[model samples]
Target: MSFKQLLYILLFFFTVSAKGSFILIPMDETTQQNHLKAYGITYWALDKQYKISWLLNYRGGSFLLPDAQEIRKECQIRGVSFEVLSDGESNSILDEISSPSQNMEAVVLERTPKIAVYTPKGKQPWDDAVTLVLTYAEIPFTPVYDEEVLSDGLLLYDWLHLHHEDFTGQYGKFFGAYKNAPWYIEQKKNAEALAAKLGYGKVSESKLA
Candidate 1:
């Protein structure tokens, strides 16, 4: 073949390859090439005439809500950070997940104290438990104490937890506890005051139970 013809063929091939070429670019802005900065492309395919939208990590259905795992997956896909949500009773799953990450000082911001205790017969336990636990765990908690429920010996700490003790001063039980115990009367007044102070409205023993 003539030299000019060979040169023309090479040019033709290069042109075609450039037109159909595929380039993978890093997603970060700092690392992307200058020319590609204004031309970044994310290609999504249309499956059918009608687009079917499916949740990336969540279960898209009735009668069920996506769990923490699904939430985590969705957060990753959407470039979002996730914070553990709790309703104040149980959070064992969060504890397990955070355990592994606990070693990283950067990720460990603040530790919230969780107070769990058993109520014994007739009275409340030590208020110092909160201070002691917080001192050791390096966490902060607001202790709750009631004069009606806890005698002078008892002290309020971290956050107050109402045991089987009836705040209504009713008795150990509800409606039943209120029927005759003087402690029940003082308990009701004290619980009301504490609830008001804590921004929770007055709740009866039944409501608490």
Candidate 2:
């Protein structure tokens, strides 16, 4: 065979072998990885980029939920990892949380507030406060109502709090204040529906407050 043909064959072999080495293709849009690396955002890993990966208890990709959901889908598609990073709202004041070395293993906190307080029991705005605090403190937590908490029974978490919640049944204040907003309306309906499903008694002002 000619020297040129032999050289071409050798180059082809090397290219095939090198393909696996360059696995990750960084995206142009702002990603959680970019934020974590550039701005120090906390995050948990979803897939293995290498032999080792990390996981976090509470995961938020970006301050914007849509953006976060997009990143999650992208990571899953790439077979890279679905990492949950604190969106930097509540977790801002809290100490920086690290990723777990194991892929599935993670540190998480489940925030369970009584439904009556969040729903009909009392309208103290504690639920919103908890969410705001979690966002600001950059802490990751799963918000659960009484039924979910009782049924799921709290699995993983280093710490837990009641968030100064009320179970009297006042309903969250945001529902009234932000009724025009889609998210607010949806949240209110969902809460009411959930309460009914759990057989929390008839929804009423006197019972909630």
Best by lDDT: 2
Off by over 4 Å in 1: 1-115, 118-122, 126-174, 204-209
Worst 10 residues of 1 by lDDT: 39-48
**Relative to the unseen true structure, what is the C-alpha lDDT of residue 162 in candidate 2, on a scale of 0 to 100?**
63
Q: Model 2 Cα displacement at 8 (Å)?
A: 4.1
lDDT of 1 by residue, 1-209 (tens): 99999999999998654332111222233433331211111111111121212212121110111223433453345443223323321134324334654431112112222443334333432434544443343333343344223343233333445445444533345545464567767755665665565455545532343
lDDT of 1: 0.35
**lDDT (Cα, 0-100) at 182 in candidate 2:** 88
Q: On a 0 to 1 TM-score scale, where does candidate 2 land against the true structure? A: 0.31
Supply candidate 1's per-residue lDDT for 65: 17
Tens digits of per-residue lDDT for model 2, 106-138? 233222222221222333344367555444433
